[model samples]
Target: MIDDAIRVLAGDCTVIAEDADRSEYRGRVTTIVKPDNTVLVHDIDGYQPVAWLTRADSVSSDRTGDFTLVAKKDTQTLRIAAHDQDGFAHYPTSAAGTPVGDCPDCGGALVRSSGVTCVSCGDRYGVPADATIRDDQCDCDCGLPKMRVERGLAFNVCLDRACESLDAAVKQAFDREWGCPEPDCDGDLRILRRGGLIAGCEHYPDCEVGFAVPAGVVDGECACGLPTFETGSGIRCLDATCDRALEGALETEPTADD
Candidate 1:
């Protein structure tokens, strides 16, 4: 979703900027107002702003066809004038572009609108805009492509429901260092619901192990080479038998240097 703090304007305008030291810069520029009301003036040739005013500064403007805007701080002031133009037009900023691929459900065009959605069947896929689809296939044997969501934060997920990797991907996204907790089981665990704290084993009917995940717990590894989680209670090993042993080792271990 587009943030409410950003305002976009396009048109021909001239800007005159003055600093506290009485230095001045004048140019024809485009303006963008941030959510915090910070004004950014941009030249036609570059992406960076040529002049700016913070939200703390006061601004005044005239609405006439030939308009004037003045922003004032302690001693600095910026004056902008609109001239020799058609008019100003506002356009919504989109981080996502045209359709990435067809919808899996009904073969409809899938485009990013808030979230990735299908234009034909109205199916909503919960993939974030920042996520990227990989060129590889999922291990689930479903021919569909796997999406690498939250590149640095999680693993790839298969969009196909017929594949088992779909469940594995959801769990890996939420749990740091997430994996199957069951002994000798290679399956992974995933959150049972979106925005919920409960996580369950993906190898259901085979490995019945599941647990209630504490809020804000980060999955990690213990000194004893076992999976661990940092909980409010403390850093405890996933295996109950190794918890006490890992706790003693952690207490005596030296912390890593920053």
Candidate 2:
């Protein structure tokens, strides 16, 4: 199964499948290449993949302007052929952009190869397209670039682990919106790692507050004077305690055009 977090490269192509029983199936299909090198051929209408090849399966490609990808596993074989010279477009996991910083693991410069991956260690850090990387250092005394991923969420991250700004930034970002939920503790909640959705408290030893972040939460604010996450259901408050408040606001609020 493909993890929700894993991005896929997809395109339209022709697929030919040969089974061990000597049966053959051929059709036009949408091909999705996963990060793990697994290939899935799906029908145009459905989400299910009609044919697939595991990463362990032997794969070979032949290109003559256009390209043909062949995968074989035991007696089963799958072939995907591109009709046009540029029938398929290669969508990289990372967009073309400037380097963020030096790799913390290897000290080599970090480039956006596949979402801010390290050139030396190949460690991938997810930076959304709109993520801001400024030339100036943050106020936290880390002297590292200030990176804000989600716009409405004020969380800024310092990619360098040696810098002490990350915890401080997190504390400031979530201070007014949501503090550490731990009882009798006042530590601020913040994101401990870059490209991750988990938020932990600054007071790790004393108050270990953590939670899974919902999608589309930004550093910006809503009319409710709290940070919000744009979920599929609707806008929701970052504080779980304010769920009922958000629901009530959504029910009463009217949409206005700018």
Candidate 3:
């Protein structure tokens, strides 16, 4: 209880007279870090950091950058600490930018990938040309979520709420980079990484031409023990592995926006 009194600073005190904690530890507020919720108190003791101080704002302190007072060994001492609103300075969580939250169009689940593009669509999230804007009134009262994805990912925001958009995006990139190179319909082929060089024509059933694959995000395994690539042509076959990949291939249905 006494310690709480010191930390909370119950009374209005004047100057930080003596030392209850670090005797020779007195310094000015140097730099502050919000990521780790720490502060550097600069003084003759060099720049020592005080970490994990909560509610440092509730009370006054000799140190700046927001602080509280503490008493040690019956003497008043200043301690750099955390305040209620300091979360933004030392927070670890990342927020989705406009248009990057739940899709305003459908309220479908959206994620802010840390990389250069949306993990689902592989589209560059930050570029305006790479995406389109809509006056979304569906949910988020504010408007479209902001785009934060960097440009290094070499993709554009599908902004598509359905898994179909994701699948299409992946296929578009893959085909652009590694065309089937087959004659007649080489460009429209689907690359399947089953166990070896697995690929087949997107125009399936009528023109069946399957290959082997070595490794990739598998769609599913056929009854014949062969893995297949899942497409948006509707559910025709239920390859076990393909089912899993298909789940990822589509966007999760979103709920209310905002």
lDDT per residue, candidate 1, 151-177, as tens digits? 223556765444645445545566534
- Please give the range of 10 consecutive residues that has the lowest summed lDDT in model 2: 1-10
Residue by residue across 1-258, what tens digits does model 3's lDDT show?
Answer: 011111121122122323433323233333333222222333335445432232233333344544454423223334443342222222223334443444443444445444223323334333333333333322334333332211112333333333223334444545433333335554445755344223565666655655542223334433333334333343323222333443433334445991
List the candidate numbers ranked by TM-score, top first.
1, 2, 3
Estimate candidate 3's RMSD in Å.
Answer: 17.6
- By lDDT, the better pick of 2 and 3 is 2
Show where candidate 3 strays beyond 4 Å: 1-26, 36-164, 169-258
On lDDT, the candidate that comes out on top is 1
Structure candidate 2, residue pairs in collision:
151-219, 152-218, 152-219, 152-220, 153-218, 153-219, 153-220, 154-219
| lDDT for predicted candidate 2 compared with the true structure | 0.58
RMSD of 1: 11.6
lDDT against the true structure, each candidate: 0.59, 0.58, 0.35
In model 3, the Cα lDDT at residue 9 comes to: 18
| Clashes within 3 Å, all models in order | 2, 8, 31
Task: Give a tens-digit lDDT track for model 2, residues 93-180.
Answer: 4333567776545676667544666555555555545556665555665444666655234556664544534446544555444566
